[model samples]
Target: MIAPLRSKKIIVTRENAGGKIFSKKISQYGGIPIEVPLLRIDCDDRDENRRIMKQLDHFDWFIFTSANGVEYFFKLANKHQISHEILNAKNIAVVGEKTNQKLKKYGYSADFVPTVYDANTLSKEFLAKFQNPGEILLIRGNLSRDVLPSELKKANLSFTSLYVYKTTINFKSKNLLNEILQREFDFITFTSPSTIDAYFELSGYLVDKPCVCIGTTTENKAREKGFSTILTPKVFTVDAMIDIIIDYINKKEHI
Candidate 1:
């Protein structure tokens, strides 16, 4: 049987590690993956991170909003020679499968994860399960949404939000820029709203092209930027995004 994404060229705009994973998935489905990374993740505010780490045991719960958060958090841990036992007292929660998988790499697993991979849904799911207010530590990136903390506050829960990593725009390579100008990409995938912004900033315009977004926030951002043929999976994960792409391709071919 022919591959669902045969001859389709999908542009992946995630950062280095994320882009590679996304590109591999695209190739697995017979799509030509274009590695046009739009952002780079960096560990920032080392002193602040160390301060937060010192108090890691005080929090009742530890939450990670993305894989970068998990990665940088562990980096700080290893740098400071902090024991894994520091996190033993707190219940852990991660926002998505990627973050969950990253947590697993550190010999840890989330105690909670939302069905939908957005801050609003994570807040609702967490609130529904644990109604009592307590000290919560949120490890996230600089560009993270306020929805999670805002919802937690509305519920009378106190939390400390830390930026474990910062995301900055990746300078588009000349070849990639030329590819965008010359090639006809079948779909452009944005993993976050930041990626969408960086992509448009680098490319100078949003083309009238089909787009796949990982979650509602990115999808909404694409729409705000005048993307008409935007698609988002019911579940916000990279695997889900590829599945939705295949389904879209199959539907188009059938029509």
Candidate 2:
């Protein structure tokens, strides 16, 4: 039998390491992966972030929206010599399975994860679970959406945002993306809103190709950016995105 993604030229727009991992997975299924890393992720170790790390005990709940958030949060914690044990006193909530898994890597587990892995769902469910919850801390990147925090404010819940990392456009990848776009590709994958923004910024114009988004938020962003054909899996992961692409290809072949 042929590989599911055989001969498919798929554009991967994740950051460096993540793009490599995603490209390998695409190649595993016989896809020709074109890696155009659009976003650069770096730990933000500013004094304010360090100060927040030092006061981890003030929050009643800790919310992590992405794996990068979890990773950088713990990295800063370690840099400041903050004990991981301090997190045991707070309830940990994560947005996705990947974030939850990343948390586990630090010898911690999420106390809550929403049924649907999105900020809106997480906020709604979190509010539902803890009607009278105490102060919350949102561990996030620079470009994290305000949906969750806005929701918390609407419910009159107290929360503080701790930006643990910064995500910026990878200008070095612009020429590479332009060179790759000269050729024909089948599908493009976007993992986050920042990636989508970076693509438009670098590429100047959007390609008329089917786009696979990692989740509803990304899909919504793609739609807003005038991408007509968008595919999003129920599960918001790179693996889920690949599976959806395979299914889309299979269905197209049958038709």
Q: Highest lDDT: which candidate? A: 2
User: Across residues 84-185, which tens digit of lDDT does each residue of candidate 1 receive?
Assistant: 877777799988887899999988889999988778888999999999747999999899999988898899888998888898888855358557757788
Q: Rate the local accuracy (lDDT) of all candidates.
A: 0.86, 0.93
**lDDT tens digits by residue: candidate 2, 47-76:** 898788878889999999999999898888
In model 2, the clashing pairs are: none
Segments in model 2 whose C-alpha atoms lie over 4 Å from true places: none
- Per-candidate TM-score against the hidden true structure: 0.95, 0.97
Q: Which regions of candidate 1 deviate over 4 angstroms?
A: 172-175
Residue 103 error for model 1, in Å?
0.9
- Candidate 2 local accuracy as lDDT? 0.93
- Model 1 misses residue 219 by how many Å? 0.5
